[model samples]
Target: MRLLLVEDDPMIGEAVLELLRGERYAVDWVRDGDMADTALRSTAYDLVLLDLGLPRRDGLDVLRALRARRDRTPVLIATARDAVAQRVQGLDAGADDYVLKPYALDELLARIRALLRRAAGRAEPVYEHQGVSIDTVTREVRVHGQPVVLSAREWAVLEALLARPGRVLSRAQLEDKLYAWKDGISSNAVEVYIHGLRKKLGNELIQNVRGVGYLVPPA
Candidate 1:
């Protein structure tokens, strides 16, 4: 999945970025609310980690603008605010979830997964289509009760497809999910990953819509 992380603290931002990357998410990070707002307006993200205290612009204002523009992308507020009123204010301002600073990494990761799953309309952690099963928490894929090994890129492609089963995603969309803002991607990278996934999972698992894009049909 692709994520935008808006944080001003160098230590915190670097730590969170590395953790998200290790979880196989392509992340673009900004240190302030202005850049965060610009990135949100210009790019597509599966989720956002927003901090309330920001330079130039307040994160709450950015959230308000995002919701005003009808951008329903799931947002998790990560800040030092711990009061009940502050938490309520964040949720009232349109954050889907909130995490206090000095939080456990595991708990933060779990909340991220929960929000992503909810946004995808998935009630369960494991996604099953046809005979293939994917454990989102473990990053494991299995076919016909047997485990299947996939490279990180292949996993990213599959995750994007499974996140919205039956919804066709164009190559560009898939590429955005696979790459961060600074990463260089080849023109045919998405196709290559699709081909590899088909080989490992099965050709029928991912279907192409002529000139449009690709999707995984509902099980």
Candidate 2:
């Protein structure tokens, strides 16, 4: 999935960027709050990693503005704001969860997973539709009770589609979920990955909607 990371610290931002990239997420990071606001205004993201202490605009204000616009994109507050009052304020401002600085990366990832799962209205960590099973935590995929290996891009496309079965996602929508601002995506990247997935899994899995886009129909 795609994410926006709003962090000003160079070291922290670099580390988190690498971590998220390693996890196969398309992440765009902006150092200042203004840049974060601008990015939020222009694009749609699956999640936002926000820091309260920010330049130009405070992270809280940025979040307030986002809520004012009625954007329900999940926001995870990761900052040094460790005080109880500050945490309450962030929750009140619309943050889905909070993680303190110097936090364990594993815990952060777990929190992110939980938020994403909740946003998708799923209580289980594993996503299953039509005998295709995906374990988000283990990064494992199984088709019809057997194991199946998928390349990173293929997995991204598959997960994006299977996140909500019966929903149609156009090419542009899939591209947005798979690419960040700096990532160079090929013209036929989605088709390539979809083809790869179809070859590995069954051809019946990911159906095209004639002139529309792709969909994972409900079982």
Model 2 misplacement above 4 A: none
Name the TM-score of candidate 1: 0.98
Q: Say which candidate scores most in lDDT.
A: 1
Candidate 1: segments with Cα more than 4 A from true spot? none
Relative to the true structure, candidate 2 reaches a TM of: 0.98
- The whole-model C-alpha lDDT of candidate 1 against the native structure comes to 0.94
Q: Per-residue lDDT for 33-143 in model 2, tens only?
A: 899999999999999999999999999999999999999999999999899999999999999999999999999899988998898889899998878899999899998
Worst 10 residues of 1 by lDDT: 157-166
Ten-residue region with minimum lDDT total, candidate 2? 150-159
lDDT of 2 at 63: 100
lDDT of 1 by residue, 115-178 (tens): 9999999879998888888999999999999999999999999988987888999999899999
